[model samples]
Target: MDYLTATKNKKYLMYISQNYSYAILRPLQQEILAQGGEVKWFLEGNEVTSSFLKNNESHLLTIEEVIRWSPDVSFVPGNVIPPFIPGIKVGLFHGFNSGKRNRKGFEDHFNIRGCFDLYCTQGPNTTSRFEQLSKQYKHFAVKETGWPTLDPLFNPDTKSIYTQPDDKRKTLLICSTFSRNLSLAPKLYQTIKTFSEQGKWRILMQFHPKMPNELVTKYQALENENLTFIETDNVLPLLKAADVMLCDTSSILLMFILQRKPVVTFCNQDPGKHLLDVTEPEKVEAAIELALSHPAQLMDDIESFCQQLHPYQDGLSSQRVLAACNELVLTNPKLKPKPLNLIRNLKMRKKLNYWRW
Candidate 1:
């Protein structure tokens, strides 16, 4: 912790993610500054998300601008690790554990490598996954500090998804999945449609970012008043307003637990492998169905079963993340091969028995 704490007075670099995450990081940035650490943000866009920096009373410099500022530690989030910035230390604030059954396609493609002077991760499982992937390629230097992105969800929500009669009220979520290994989407939609038609529930749609806007517009046009379509980049606020979350394998469901809402994962794998290779369509479907068996109440045992689902969601996650970044910077090696071997290797196995955990 000292290694990370040493950044008490250092000027750190941070790669900005979506608008939602910026809010969570703001307080941490304040703490960093209060301790004499100066923070520079590498934001995605200058529109809405960046606007919060002003209220948080923080500052954001574009990547191009940050290059000129040249801080001691560069923290990376979701975007492709930036190109070479001469004369700067790199600290990786990694977002996704790419290369596993849980990782999304865009997330798995471009991973920031060992070039990071320091690497911070979601947790041990993620470290393990990177290690396993390294066995097939390069080594990784990573520390598990949990996800700072979930900082906003640790606290219980002030409200529920809904309190109306469970059978008559519905909370529909527009959702997406990481890997669809079975014929689950259509069937899952059928399940929701059936439930709604029976006056048991309503639908709210939360579309993925990568999805085409026109497609979302078309889906939103579905003639259903009970269905509320989420079009904004920020979905957490909406998730907070919801009661029951319906989606297929979105990491967001983990956040939904903060709302005490139940989750339903939809798989559409008709004998296809979206992840690297290993996938069990039947088991995935069975697990999700069983978890949602409480059609009357969502997430009957979510808090207890969170470990199997997320594995690294401790509430004070941001502080751990800071420690991880600092640890990497202190121990980070230059141009190491197989930077992520151990982690990737352990988690390369399928997520078959996890739900049972």
Candidate 2:
């Protein structure tokens, strides 16, 4: 069977749970539409705002409607997807693995819960591990297709929302993980506030959607001529706008580093040569200064890290992902049956009120 032909007129469902999933999956949607395929979105959970859906986009309101539509494939950015949904489940993970660990002390990125038939990984760092798990489970396939979200970062045609300030000072993007134990927003608040008052750098602050409201309020209060608090579904523009980034244990730092820019992490869980990891809040300012200098060794380390993290800079990851999905659908390679996952499915059913088997 011709896989390329198989993709024509295909039906796809963008399974979204968080606001950021929009940025991650929209590139793939554009690619799907370009290939003469149909795309629809299914916004799950209350976290995703329905207003984000544009006038041109189509979305199903209920599971029954989703069943009636009967898509050929469902692309999920979040961890869970209902098995009852009629489609080949494909996991397009939300973010890179920035060494964040779960409550059980195990890395959360590599945890396979048997919810997907295939995982289109970001790069070698993730592909190799998922491939090993695929062999062990014999229930899924792994393909390294870079990340669809970063396609706009490299794509020249894509317009960025970022506009340069007239002052032309260096921009420092500050982001933090929501994890209470790993968050730097609280710890570095004073330091960042001082930086803003001094007006040495243009500060842009964005935080995880799940970050504490109190901390968000505090940061928002710091907004001044030099400091700005940003709230948006997509962070790609911010990544492109910043000259340097300050983060702590958040995957966004990894995304920023992919641009060959320097990042300063405050008490990062897994520090490496690529990052200027500082344990003390007082040292953060110095680290930012160092990162701005772009030392030879640090820049080289960042280059090496990017190659391992995500080598594809061609802005065609969406095409590659669609090709992978088409090949899987057309060929239908034999593989072990996926596990029942009774409890998880039960929870999903309860959440969606979808009882039909």
Candidate 3:
């Protein structure tokens, strides 16, 4: 029997994120708990052990132990053919944001890909793309709720943490993270040095998680009174303080686009490059240097990129996500469709060519 049938909680189950905060996870969880639903967490990664959960009172079970209990919804739930507890409603955290492959290319990864009644989405195009590719996957017409980590970006309290720079220097915030692929680092450093020589911009280097210690120290050693490298979680506050943002598409692009600031995306990753058209290396180098020298050109690039980059600016995407989840598990429930039906629907949608959007 489904655990909800017996325990009688809201029958909504949340898969825990290693990093938790009011940003995205907390609000949905708060909604769940407020409705008298039992909120359970599966502890596996650092997310469960994350200091963020220290004082909060919630029932947490290890991933291995969860097999004995019934799970209603999981973030990626159990890999394949998840232990289907009788009477448990099912849901999943949706999106494959890391890779360039569209919904069609990722079909091979799903063990029981079509089993969920509800699939929460990342944006409108993501919703349209998935529904076009898999008829069984329902993409509700709500705010294409953006990611949760961004919730703090929308918070009012977050604004006060920043201090505007002095009049002498225009701050250039370089947002970077540790990539197993280091090809882009040397070029990026070279580009910054070229700009700094002009003495028009102050460069602040932001390191990504897992950045090499040597790499951090190498840049730190060259510190111009104008150059500073920071590795903490204060990237957003830094973005607010800056005149411009330069990063290799680390979702910080979303933050800048939301703030309506100009941004330059580095397309250095191999498998997951940016989808939009990018300037060539010569064009890129010239643009960066020219923009740095002039700085006013940032407004033009900001406006240009906004056409393709800023679709999910609704800002209240979290609420739409919770509504979609509630509809699937609470208001209306459906069963997983057969893979054959899913593929057949995919084939049918091709004639409509809705995937082109």
Candidate 4:
């Protein structure tokens, strides 16, 4: 029997680098708690704030505190596993957009650099990719558990399509990746502004947490009655709230696509026929109108695309992830000591302002 079905309690430790990581682990944490499992969160870096602690009700753990705790499993969304931590290190992934490219071939999104003992993949595409990498690297395991961050989206009772009052205006969510060259924010700001000012639509803008501060400030100044600037780490609510999402080269586009809503991508690195691809900033307005006007035309394509990402729409993805982790704990009872990389650890410690001995 799985931990959820078993009558015993287990412990889960979450390693988070930023506030946005909470979205990826919150659903899993809820599931773990529901299954008589306890979870403790550790902030992995020094750039934390008092406001984060107050909002999350979690304390920051030093490297010593983390080692002393020695959790059964450590869930991380970022790449670094943090040297000398005990337990099964699991990478839950931050996003599903893996088909893009950097100067290097294939962009290395799903590449396993031995950071995780197990990876809870969002869907088949990611799983298949990681499976190949795992075979080649001869370490780590891949589990096809859908992303926990999107679990709330599949729940009917908790899913809210609109947070705003019923003004009956069409809602458009604008988002972008942090890449300056790939992001559409700089190129399409004027176009978005023009549309928002028309009063025909309600614009909700949520940028990547890594987006440059100056760009965030510039967009913050654009907030008004029709346009809302979202700065929160949790985007599940915003993802559910929006009628349509406008983005560029973001896996978030796939999340919105899973909603079966229309998505307009501006200069996406991996443009798909399922999405309305706008290469030019000038064409974004027309694409928005096209999406809002005839979303039904794209329903079949959207569903097909969603299936490739994740087959589950029943909100049990978090449960599946927990099941996978529990299976790892049960089968691999002896914890393997993660090999220490002194240079890497020291570099990270210095960068995050941890004590260097």
Q: How far out, in Å, is residue 217 in model 1?
A: 1.2
TM-score of each: 0.64, 0.98, 0.63, 0.91
Backbone clash tally (model 4): 0
Model 3, span 54-171: residue lDDT tens: 3664555543345446555444332222333222333334222333333465532232344444445565535565555445344222224555434555666667344543546677
Model 3, runs deviating above 4 Å = 1-43, 46-49, 52-54, 57-61, 64-117, 136-143, 160-162, 165-168, 177-183, 193-199, 210-213, 220-225, 233-235, 267-286, 289-314, 337-357
* Superposed Cα RMSD, model 2: 1.1
Clashing pairs in 2: none
Instruction: Give the candidate order by descending lDDT.
Output: 2, 4, 1, 3
lDDT score, residue 249, model 4?
A: 88
User: Against the correct fold, how does model 1 do in TM-score?
Assistant: 0.64
Instruction: Please give, for residues 1-357, the per-residue lDDT of candidate 2 as tens digits.
Output: 545456788999999999999999999998899889999999999999999998989989998999999999999999989988887899998899999888899999998899999899999988899999999999999989999999999976766566475768999999998988899987888899899999999888999999999999999999999999999999999999899999999999999999999999999999999999999988999999999999999999999999999999999899889888999888788979889999998999999998887
| Sequence-dependent TM-score of model 2 | 0.98
For 249-310, candidate 1 gives per-residue lDDT tens digits of 45555566544556554442211122111133334434443444544333445544445334
- Flag the better candidate by lDDT, 1 or 2: 2
Candidate 4 lDDT by residue in tens digits, 46-151: 4434355445445545766766777888899887776557778899877786367757775667655566888888887677878887676656777898988888
Q: lDDT scores for all predictions?
A: 0.50, 0.92, 0.49, 0.79
* Residue 29, candidate 4: C-alpha displacement in angstroms: 0.8
